[model samples]
Target chain A: MNSIVPDSSFTARSIAENVQSGEWSAVEVLEGYLSQITQHESEINAFNTVLEEEARATARETDKDIAAGKTLGPLAGVPVALKDNLCTNGIRTTAGSRILENWKPPYDATVVQRLSAAGATVIGKTNMDEFAMGSSTENSAFGPTRNPHDLSCVPGGSSGGSAAAVAAGFAPISIGSDTGGSIRQPASLCGVVGVKPTYGSVSRFGLLAFASSLDQIGPFANTVRDAAIVHEVIGGHDPKDSTSISEPFPSFLDDLERGVEGLKVGIISELMGGIDGISPEVIQKTREAASVLSENGALIEEVSIPASLYCLSAYYLIAPAEASSNLSRYDGVRYGLRVSGETLAEMNINTRTEGFGDEVKRRIMLGTYALSAGYFDAYYGKALKVRRLLAENFDEVYSKYDVLLSPTSPCTAFKLGERTADPMTMYVNDVCTIPSNLVGHPAISVPFGSGNDGMPIGVQVLAPPMQEALMYRVASTLESAEK
Target chain B: MTEPISEKEVSHVAHLARLRLSHEELQLFTKQLGAVLEHAKDVEALQLDGVEPMSHPLPMENVTRKDEVHKMLDRDEILDQAPVTEDGRFQVPQILGEQP
Candidate 1:
């Protein structure tokens, strides 16, 4: 097995293979990742919290299991990072809000529980947009996560921390939640593979809610196969989460090696044209990728979904409306930070005033207004209707096409502060990806090309809901062609 | 129909969300909110006469689990972590009013 190193060659499977075979110990893997975090933490700000001591302790137990002739689980001895939004037992799960800076959960999230049960060591928690709002990770109260490819640019967000962790080699894989474009956007910017599993495919019991209906926990890794490995560990049903699917998880590992030969592929015609702010180079690369699929015995056709143009508009309305209601639980009386005053109203005011970052406060306000009694019929209601139309449109396309493809973002990662003041511009960055979230389908971002600036560009593949196997096969084919 | 946000409305929403905005933040968010909400105008333009509002795409019923006691952090272990706590419970300034 290739020794784990701080480069593209090192991945989760590579590290796990080496660790299990006794060529490397779990401690060596932990120390290697910790050292990388120490070296690159300043450049990427990938981690919100790094508990080296606990990780080493867990690693020791893992090595003991290996030595004691215990049957090792898949991903046994692999070190992974959890997104800050995930509830980690005894770890500060801030969700990037100052309000929850010191609030540790009493229990682990289902995904965290599953990861640990599979024998993966949780190294640390990665940064995220505060409460998973905002397109760029800059909305993090802690500070922005810089891009690993170029230190001055963003790593894409609200999963920027996870993407940067994988890109900078702080960890081979990290788990992130995608409410909108959180997983795929950051993965695109950081040049990694990120999958937002089909909604209802993963349990959301311990995830900090942004838009509950749209949120799904997925994996970020340097390879599609490694993502498949991690997703398999954490993807399943839990009685605690009703929305989790009762349907069986497809054998992603088997599907990944399954060739994409003769697969019917649809390229959204509207995604190629009509969108502004797209780079010509990105369009060219997507076309090249489509051509590669065509040459590989796959059928590629141009399909149109007219409702896609309204995705951003509908998303902004629905996400905020849900966020407004979901976030109301934090009233300075529950878990986390509270600023008290002489009266209850004043206490709520002072607490929220100081606790939430500006972007979070912005969304909360926007959501509150949208869900307010009178406006609900027009704003939230209308958006839900449009969401249904988009879902229907996707069903129509998937009836003809096995999978849909587009550029993950209009361009490569932009400079960190470029669109902070322009929320519209930032929202547009999610144009190609948000439609999937609205439709509650599955999508993955696979790196396609290096732009003129040497930053990575990603092409997205969207699949009908619960059809992750089709996506893995297509993405695996593309990943092979790139190699 | 455009329900353009007024300065008064922005302040009201801020009060509801418990945010004490500076005059600068107020001015900035007012313009920003207007533009953001203006984009919401397109949402009203969508047609859905017979469509049922979907809260989640997945078809799910009550997800309630049995009330069996699972392993949980002991009160001492949990309250030991509270930034502010009293005898056995998490202590906060009287939310409804001040403590005696």
Candidate 2:
């Protein structure tokens, strides 16, 4: 019999403690979340596939380990969902694209392996954009995920489903990959704590490559500490990913209580300025967040990032160029979808044409054109220099300030199909988040307050490479201020 | 703004990208991609001849590991996902032929 009654405070931390102390079994914890998913999933549609029996079996094994006197890991019984892009051995993993609707991996992603070692239960694979391409989950081939806050609104993509899963209470934590604003944008739209650890800080061995240089897998949770716990579990160097940082990762959860006292926080001036599409409510909320941090013993000042305004242009070129090269593997023969034709080349062409969605095709065409011989210097090459400018600007600021601040998204959750017809408008949603990706910095989104529309707004905290501990400290400060 | 990409260029890029587009898709994408490129023209307008291009976020290069054999996935299991297979290998359509 369970001794402790689960309440509003029953988070990942509570669930792990209760299971470790034998107050609740791992199976019971899994069952509670499974029930929540079943009750709420139809309207929200966060997950592409829910591993009901698979999660149950894993939970039972954990219970058996406890009975056999094995010690519990940090997230002993916590249920964690995965973005569909992360590969799972023997499980059908689609990157929310029709091409790989039935594809299964031969091995687990490094993060998935690490989570298992840390005693977390695998719950489900959530939905996302086709090849993690768009800013809204509407780009998904299967279907779009409605924001949990308002069933009519979108959960920002391409990691929309992962963000929605955590927001909906279907899982205490979920994993999402950030390429540009994929993780943080959706987290803000969904009113949850989401983190994008420093580039190469977390291994990307089995993450389906979108923009390889920009991609980093991180966690989404209800609290900063929960995100920190999962971040520590999944992060570190892996030989499988050659670009992963080999340095030792610091303990983020241990550093959470350090607070923002005496910390110098710089607000990114351009993001808060009169940028188009920024709701007045979101701007007000970000200004309020600055004031709260100031009252809590931190110094705040506005800092200009001139190159940041150009990040969207540079990131659009860079990410699509990488994606066009990475997605070339979806040819008919080896795995996934195959459309037949007279010759191999024709078959490959037909397969991709039938398999990819409209948004993905537009990007591939744009990317190929950018990399073509005549235009290479004008587009892709120019974008790289702009990336360098963004990096230099960030490095100069990090020397003086511990962390920089910005609104996570220009506005809150957008209604479905609001910006679908216009591609440039959709691309504008990531303007604030793209600079961090360009410079290999770490950034996180913590919910600050709600808009006049009653939807949540997020204030982003960005830090230099390997400074996630300081990043989480600011995140925790904002989280506490909300209370 | 004027269209930054022409329909002829879009068709060429689509073919190069292994995607076959219909007349409607070609026209629609030409306008859409042109608008996107027009927005991206700011980068093109900047004079940055002195700055070197950054291709990746990480600064590391020439990463290599010891040439040691480790456990590999089973060949049969790997081959199981193939659309066409024969003689324990993936099979493909004739590459030299022009048509059926």
Candidate 3:
């Protein structure tokens, strides 16, 4: 295991280049990661499944292709982990719920197919909050993933496992979904780079639905460039997903190193000042990040989207309202855990009662109540109106600024059970990240600096829809400053 | 807005969700749900007259595809995932109640 310590600097791009040029065989890289996973998996618990044999087989084939003078893909031979919600052919795709524990999909997700076509080796499925419903991975049925930085703290959810995998060097890059900050929040906690592309930029075909309108699959990596590399490969239109954007994918890596000089950046005023529960260290780091951009010749100013203050309330309504309908498919008949009872209705009730976790059940009830006949206009309808106002507010801000910046999470990662007792407190962890999801804008969380207790703090860069290249430019600029 | 949710209301909502909860869970949810809904009252307080509800972030309408048949998942592989299967389909409990 100690033999691969020198390879820690390999980014996804460098790994592919090395493997393609025969400087290092793909098998060697795969073995190095396997060794790291073996050494760190117990304490980190980042992976729900490990595709050791499959990865080795894929690496051997990639090496053989290189010998045959074949053209290689950009991600050729890179070992990438998938969040468990993405369907992988012949692999167990559990959304960290007991219901899908033994079920394996017969087909692959569009992103999975694309990754395979690009010559990337599937490492394994990473863990997530069951159905991606919670801010902490504590809701995962398989158990929580501990933060690699400190084992006592959480890695953030529901993409905790993917972020931890990247930070712990189990893999250079991994894929995770963001529905109201699942990817960015976890990446912030784990001290890695995570991107939530503009909704519809990445095809969502085969991503397990969790608030369909908010979900978007993206990447996690140790560097901005690596995250961009994976993002380009996984993005683009898929006819299979109706919501996928029908335009050609842009070259994200081309503008990555372009720097943020002359770029107009704004600090979201609503996210700053007199906010409860925000740590002083987080505020200082955010200010320092803004200064770094300003000193680099970028223009910075404060902008407000007052309607964003209600985004949390609106998201809690819209997301669960959508989730209640999307998750209704898990009734005891077709697939998943089926608990038998005297009658069909009783069986359906029993199966759900046993299959779902507490947070999931609570959301389902909330959604059901909100969407019920009498309360629909008061709760779900009003939330939708608020959603429009938030979107309009973002539109207004984008008219004046090229990008918006904010602290990814109000505070650094806390102990595992710190806020599990109070759901609202846990929900507040997403306050800064959820607005971007609601507006369908692209956002990335870059590791800015350390906060209290030496835990990593992330600063987010948000851009209007389809402006991922600009977002990456600013992100890479911040990333280079850190280095 | 701070009205506490009744146990009966929690039970009714759980029934609508097809979820069975213990008496303890019912009481817990009644309190928790009340707190969440109380927080949610902020949305209702706004004057949203004439505001159109935005269902999706992207402004797209009925995204229909071309009418062409495509490959589907293998039947046997799909059936293998079901907990109970009959002759080529999922087997479920009888839909009609037993004859009186």
Candidate 4:
């Protein structure tokens, strides 16, 4: 039966195209997603707030636009999920934290506005680590988002819910912020295509700040072409975000069929073996992907970025230092939760102590200590220097290779409570993806094969800044070869 | 490994960050933070004499725009989200004096 609204296995491109051709009503597409959500959302815990009424209204509007013979944007009937950090006007925008649990933003984030303008109906706000801090969704103040593949295991995070939503068929496309692999890591675990575009490629105006210098908004989708489409629609210059790159965004979808013939791909050596916590199966799958590209006429080689060894160490210092500064705005006087006290300072202290989770507090303290008077030079300053050296190392490689390859995560999804007790153990998950964020380059994780545990393994393809088309060509190749 | 940071130091940093931790939290953080910091110490081993420190990934020049008035978020809506509001302004506890 060719059911128009059957269970699972839907793509954003198909939905938009079908709606445009009057083959499927926008209502039918939304209901297909809603039916999936109704059946599985409670079990997956992927969303903190499902915008059912709002999504229905938008879907109806999309149908109206099509009936009126109006030209719609690229994503006419697509359902999108947003990481809780990105604001939605008048909707609760909790970054999966206790503090902002009931907080509603008065305005939409720039990304939200752009998605709406592109005719995508935002179905829900997905759960995430409290302030997007953890590698697993365990740091979420609500509850952890479980992997759709294995209910007992984690979907990688802080963008866990965004990935899980797409994996669980709640949404075909989703938006998440990647500070240090938040998008790609979870996408790898959930067997979806996740992208972290060039640092300033997407506007960050509405994304709740985690580490402003490192945070970049990206998408998770069922295919590389869909990811490229979503990326193009949401990317480009915005007057609202001062840091947004003013350059014109290239048509990423056009490059999908361009293919990776005669392209140079480097397997990042430090991430492949030199770093700790990488599993044999993950490495094997990544190597197999490299050969697959080689078979498809791509040149493959082993290249070393020595500074990648220190990226995790340096990132902890640099990201936390920036976070400490960004998260200070959560005082009781403004939006969100506030606990009372006699004095103003005491009120501020009490508010933060009760509002934030243990992981967030740990980061705040770590950041404060690093930026404090005595330890500033030794920790934060030195970390900044290491960041530069790592960027320089990657740049040296970029001069030779069109893109770099590595595992998106160290291993497949660990059991829910496996690494929650130890922050250091969980931090190792970002070892491969952090280097790209540090260098402000674009990267994507393509689901290549399965690990020994039967969980999906994702092979990451990274390119130099503004080279997403080149990166997507390789990712598209890997995705097609998987079948 | 021995603790690189003491409980007292953790409390001090916590105070600076405006987070009041429980006695148990202080104990846990001191041990956990010490190990994380010890790992971060690897950066100190790098010979970074001439490498210029990079704070932002892109070489961003100061972005200036003509000071023009634009539509802003409604003042009432902003106030409505505040935890404490009075007369359309965010209300806070006293700044200078002790508890009245």
Candidate 5:
């Protein structure tokens, strides 16, 4: 019965069309994914919680809706996983932290509500770095999510589980939040398509805040078109999120297949330098990808934004500073884990010490130090100035180019425990993708080719803010060319 | 360009963050935080004499919403997740010092 639907290549569009037309039932598709999850979940640890019975109930309801001749939304009958940071009413959302181990949100995040309204079944909550803090999923309190492509290697994080779930066919699509390359880096490592939309394009309401200014929820899919389909459904304004753009968003799928003819593409020279620890294969693959676009009528040139060399430094300071403030809500008085102590202040200190992982603690301390009375101007303040300079640098380049191109990561997936020993080495993993987050530009990672140890390499396409449609066109072009 | 973070500094920052840390954690954090700060020195090397800092990428300011009544979460449902509660209020350790 399950063989009716292909396990690995089930896309959201195909499932929705077939279910709506009665060629295949939503229950059948759900069964197919459940079986896949049962088979691969232990190996990958892609999911933190699997809502088996609830998802089955939702699938049955959708089948009835289809029978009644109701018009379905874009995501009808589709099964999607969400990064655990996004709140799901009545479901435990841990953000991969022990503090929220037993916490169930009373309300759904805007994206979750939107997905449900679109007739998509909430399959489960995927794992992540504890509070979305680490470069790899190693910081997850539940456990690390291994790369589906190679179990010994890490699925880049803090969106590793979502990316791995898509790559392993647990779900056709999943939502991930990117703050300094969480989504794109993992999507690249897992050999799937991932997007980090323009900062204000998606509502952040109900997403457990992590460096709120830099975080943006996005989708991971097996195809560029599928990603765009999910993107169109989850984007737009919400009064609940003040940072959300009030402007209307065009359908991303509308211009996705449009080729990048006569478009100006810039390959960032700063990212191409071999001195930055970028593997040779990644560099070669990115250059090859550029030539393919050039042959297809897009004019390509090398552009330099020297300030981007300092992006990681600026991000490490700025993101943690924001995170320190955002995470202060977890005092023992409210929801989440509480460890008893002699007094209120002692209890607060003990609960945090017991609940947060080492990386989370490190970031919190860094933030507190940076925002301290005497040091604010030297660290946090200076990083903000650099952030402004980085944005200006990108704006200057976007004036002459439609999109910028680079390797998604300096290298392909590294072995588990490879860079975990050194925090700085792991931080460098996001060197190529961090600038996009710093400047609030939209970016996507598409698997270009394979590199060392037969692992996949991803090439990132970045466009100016609110120019997601143009970025998708170029991404789709590269995706099709790879095929 | 800046002083390396010390055990005392890590302990002080931990206190500010309300995070209790043991001596071992303090030592480890001191080393790690020092390395991270050392790397951050790159931003200080840049010459930015009079650049305005950008706290957020979007240029919008004072995004005020109209004052209107809307649906709020049920108190019972929200209190369900609280570790300890009494009469619909969160229970916590005493904030004020004990009476002499």
Candidate 6:
């Protein structure tokens, strides 16, 4: 059995091919991954819940199917990890918060259902920022998921665990939710490919709503082609989730090797030279990527999005405001942990106090205040207006450019506990990403550079709503060229 | 121009939001919130003279759907999540001046 390593480049396709040809047994694959989790999970702190017996049984069944000449799906017998937020039947689906620590969903999320139907064996649930609220995994109720690249450093969250798992080879690929770049940011930091599908393309049913309008489920893989393969399986309509569109799904795998020839790539000048805290190395890498695209026959053009300056400000208001409402469902009334006191108010207070982490409480308070009667017009409503303007600006740019390019994050993974005390500083980490969420467009984060600290930094590719295949083609070309 | 918001207003909002704060938290959040209001102040300063406020991204009109019978969750499952419940209703302490 091969041990899982940080740079284990064998993808789901390669592993499946070996397993199907009887070259590698499904039992061996599961056992190998199990051994990997046992060896590395302590150092990485990636998984919050591990399903060892369940995975072993599934692997046995897969072996039986192969013996019987069963028609195996593309990812049959392949081990994949999942972010904790995606609900699994009878499994603890904690969204990295104490409130739902013991809450087991009665049904599987659409994505989970699809993955199972596609013959992928789910190994475990991974850690994330509490309620997918923070940019770092430090906010997880269980504990922070450490970066695989540097043990002492943080894993970018709220899909940090998923990214870290894929990077560290705990699993070949994992599904992660991207709301405000949760998937891609971590992918960039961990040197993996994380793609956030266009809004409303994937079903959000059973994804514990953290900003319903912006939340999307995507795959994190070591290779862009692997990510595309996983995305195609999980991308489609579901009657269970009304937000999911009944549109024809694109053949992401079929378009994996498509180059960006004659494509118009917009280099957002403001994102490149605009921010103060961004490092020179990030800018250099971005410029280099732009040049490569230009060299590859892509028409690179400088684009300015002036309203992007207010994206962070707008995000804070809108995300918190939506979070406050979404989190209201967690009040000791629904399936989760509950604390009690003599009075009703005291009971509610005690339950929330013990159940919620500091960051979740802080955001809830901020959101509640922002959406309060007198303050709604001033904060939430105004933010909505700015969000519109930003979306319109992106629309105008996309009318000309095929896709917009910028650094995925301002910087790479910082040391663990670096920004725990300073919330404002932490919020700035999502400056480039928050715009995509606000505009309800799709974006992907692919590794482009090694930061000054030698950690991975990602380049973000933004496309207009439902233009994910276009973004995927450009990203794949860049991904191929880098290799 | 943004009108000055009082600390009392913040306190009231906090109450509605169910936040239990120390004296220090209140003071700190107030000052920080006040400083951040400048952006909103600037946004309010915009000449959105004829622009109607947008609620959603898509230009959706009045959407009405037919009501259909769906299987509601079982009483046991519904009650399974409550911190405390009695007689199929969520339980809370009876308030002297409040209605259930």
State the TM-score for model 1. Answer: 0.96
Off by over 4 Å in 3: A1-7, B98-100
Q: Over the stretch A64-181, how does candidate 3's per-residue lDDT look in tens digits?
A: 9999998789988899999999999889998999988887988899999988888899998998999998877989999898888888889999999898888888898999999999
What residue pairs clash in candidate 1, if any at all? Answer: none
Q: Where is model 6 chain A poorest over a 10-residue stretch in terms of lDDT?
A: A1-10
> Listing candidates in order, what is each one's chain A TM-score?
0.97, 0.98, 0.98, 0.98, 0.98, 0.97
lDDT of each: 0.86, 0.90, 0.89, 0.91, 0.91, 0.82
DockQ of all models, two decimals each:
0.58, 0.78, 0.75, 0.75, 0.80, 0.41
lDDT of 5: 0.91
Q: Model 5 Cα displacement at B58 (Å)?
A: 0.3
Q: Tell me the tens digit of each residue's lDDT in model 6 across A1-483.
A: 122345445789888887787778888988988887888888888999989999999899999988888867778888999999999988889999888888888778989989988878999999999999888899998989988888878879889999999888889999999878899889998889998888777888879899887788999998887887888888888878766777786677676667888999999987887867777888888888998889889999889998788777778888888988888776576568768666666656777868888778777877887888777877788888887788778888988999999998888888888988767778878888888887678889888868778888888898887777888888987887677
A10-97: candidate 2 lDDT, tens digit per residue:
6788888888888899998899889988888987889999999999999999898888888888899889999999999999999999
The local distance difference test score of model 3 is: 0.89
When superposed on Cα atoms, how far off is each prediction in RMSD?
2.9, 3.1, 2.2, 2.6, 2.5, 2.8
True contacts kept of 4: 0.88
Q: TM-scores across all candidates?
A: 0.96, 0.97, 0.97, 0.98, 0.98, 0.94
- Candidate maximizing DockQ: 5
Chain A TM-score for candidate 5 is 0.98
Candidate 4, residues A50-85, lDDT tens digits: the string is: 999999999999999999998788899899999999
For model 1 chain A, give the 10-residue run with minimal summed lDDT: A1-10
- Which residue segments of model 2 deviate by more than 4 Å? A1-9, B1-3, B97-100
Worst 10 residues of 2 chain B by lDDT: B91-100
TM match of model 4 to true structure = 0.98
Off by over 4 Å in 5: A1-8, B98-100
